[model samples]
Target: MAWWAWLLVQSVVWCSAGVVAVLWWLWVTKPHVDIPGPPTLPIIGNALDFLEHPVTVNKIRDFHRQYGDLLRFYAGPKLVVLAAHPDDIQHVMVTSKIVERDPLTTSAMRSFVGDGLLTLNGSRWKTHRKLINPTFHSELHGNFLEAFHEGSLYLSELLATDSAGGAAPADVHAAAFSSAMRSFCIASIGVDPDRLIPDISKHEVSAVMRRIIVLMQTMMVRPWRRSLSLLRLSSEGRAILMYYAHLRKSVDEVIALRSAATEEGPAKMRRRLLETLVKPGGQTAIPLSEVQDELMTMAVTATDTTAMLMSYTLALLALHPDWQDAARRELKDVFGEGGDYLRSPSLAELASLRVLESIIKETLRLFPVVPMLPRILTEDIRLSGGRVLVPKGTILYVAPFLTHRLPQFFPDPLKFDPSRFLEGRSGEEHPCSYLPFGLGSRNCVGSQYARLEIKVFLATVLRRFRFLPHSRWEDLENSVLSITLHTFKPIEVYCVPLQESGL
Candidate 1:
């Protein structure tokens, strides 16, 4: 044989040997626990499976049906256990003693949010939760009622103008986002929306936030950038750094102003949510970095999710004019032909709008803003009704999207029946069946705050205008999964003035 031929043959033999040795090692070191999942190829595992589904919640739902509650899949090299059953969700979210967040998800978010309540785990999470809980109490939220009312009115005016008094379709998602963002700023950050610095105006800040959410979702799915050094050089990475810098700069300015004002006199300072964090003297004077993280978390959590809920609820109500009429009738009875229903309602009045509340609940159930909740298993967990053992370090996912759709919990699951959520009408449901805000210790801290904002916005808008179906209404559910679910296409609806519509 020729020397070149001999060399090529040797190389092939050695490469084959190396591949065999690696496969042998993998087989020997594989986890001992038996769990059901899609068969994975070596090295890549189920990465291709994820790539195929990408943003499809239904694919994951199919896996839940096929695998029965817990499906053990590998993303790249990481083991991910998807838990869909209410019992499993109850244990993972509420019952599990270990509540550490999945590093993969939280670490990605920490860049934008810092070590706030959303990203923190263990003692840090506990500490921040305790500190922030009081800020969300009804009294403080009540103070923001006027902010919600104002924000909703602003949205109504903007929509009416955009629609040319219901002569054309207006993008409700855009209007809802602006309205919710404004409400979040006033209620959570304690800032006047108009006064937010020109450099980081509401529209600019929203652009930055949208960039961050989209980039974060992209990174989480692809995860190609290996390190901070490599990531900083990429286009997406560079853009995020710039946008986050703008975001942080705005937050820092607000913090600085609050701090200086705090120094002047405690009595003079109005205790808004942001002020509560920066106030001097507590078990721990929260560092500015921590406060910024919490603020970012609060901003991200409150804005998109609230907007999504409002947009979806309004769209659904538009589809069912009878329900819209029902809600408006309730509003008319409570506000009596509208003399400042925009202002705060009494607790008694809020309770009376049961139809609107039910509609919101039903909307949240059909389209949960945070579709998948992820956690890291700090300890080994039992799975499949205790038939399988899941090893530690596995990523656990509790899918409220899947749970909310299960037929056992929701009859005629795909139906848009607001009456299903009416008090006493709902049959015995698994405690974890309808978790639009999640469940247990780590449930969304501002759930009540979100609910109130939605109620205020819905009531204010429905009273002034009637939502009529538009051209884009048919594609409302074609949503892309950002950090929160967002419509893949813009959603527009006709906003007819109540008087014009003869409602």
Candidate 2:
């Protein structure tokens, strides 16, 4: 009605228009660096995708089918690019700029294991890598063969005691973890856990490992809980801190014992990796904290991982009796029917078991324990295949699970056939296709050790027992991703003692 009133209303309308215009400009032209990915809600991005599909392997696999090799999505506000193609994986892992681990993954891992080689980056990573590299050399693993033999014997006895008589099914994974942990203690810390640290059994370590798994799965699936403040408020998070404290204490005890032995006796008396790390010759001395971090990293990666692989391979063999019999025959050929295999076999003899190696390789292809290896690009990466733009600060995940199953790399990838790994077939495939131990400079350090442990444990167990599947293969297909891929329950198998099987 009044001229002044009209002017006031016009001012308010113009202010609102200016605000909307600025917002629109920011929304449309902010930055178009995002790669192809699933649809996202405003602000939330693709965080819900993890919640809907908790199993990250299947989620990445399904996304690859829908979005092709390279796809970008947000974990909370952070952008992550999933590189599924073998070429892209190779490029990211081997050729990418400043191939450091994603901050989220590194932070989470560090929270559990401290700043070990697995979590370190740049100069620190390089220094530690050089220091720790010699400890896992092929020659060093040979000294630990007796440990493997003893651990495998303990596992067999444990199974025998559990099954007692009459084809009773036992948890193969349980046995595998027990043996693997002891072997790790023996090889890494130079201590027989059963004799020195009776209480630090797989049962205890697994309880801690399970909690760590829950903490990781929770943080991954629920982006809201990924924050340090939020995680500290949760029970699983608190349990993780407590577990780490306990782990540090136990590791310290082992280190102290090793140190005393090394100090009191000649250097020749000490052969374990811990001795080398504790009293490194001609290398920079590693800090106790750093040693603990590396030890924890090895304990988690080498022990349960190799154990799980052994269990999965055995389960697969159980499901396919032909392969089981074939592997057993190969074992017999190499070890000569319980001659030295039960006590100790040299690395050369172990490597001679080609069929068993093939089976393990195939199992790793199908059920890669560390299914998704993640790296963060410090700068923009134009992928090799499609020249996909993975922007700087972008987290790239190399999904071996998806790439391993691609028909291009692996024919009939679902089929549990070890023949594909029998030399010529797998050698013909892309090198990046099989990355159960990851790729590039930052690939798993204990890979050689892991392979040796698997071969030794498998040969020992298969020699003494015949594993029969307790569940259908289809049921076993469902796996939970927690740093490593694992079945929801312990994989059960009928452990028929070789004498009873009459093979």
Highest TM-score, which number?
1
lDDT of 1 by residue, 181-228 (tens): 778778877778766533433344444455566666666766664244
Residue-level lDDT of model 2, residues 209-311, one tens digit each, is 6566656766655645665555567776665566567667777777766565534345453345676677533231677788878888877777778767876
Per-candidate Cα lDDT values, in order, are 0.74, 0.73
Off by over 4 Å in 2: 1-34, 195-208, 221-243, 259-271, 280-284, 337-343, 384-386, 426-428, 500-502
TM-score of each: 0.87, 0.86
lDDT of 2 at 175: 71
Task: Supply candidate 2's per-residue lDDT for 121.
Answer: 92
Worst 10 residues of 1 by lDDT: 197-206
Runs off by more than 4 Å, candidate 1: 1-28, 52-54, 197-211, 226-243, 262-270, 280-284, 338-344, 471-474, 500-502
TM-score of 2: 0.86
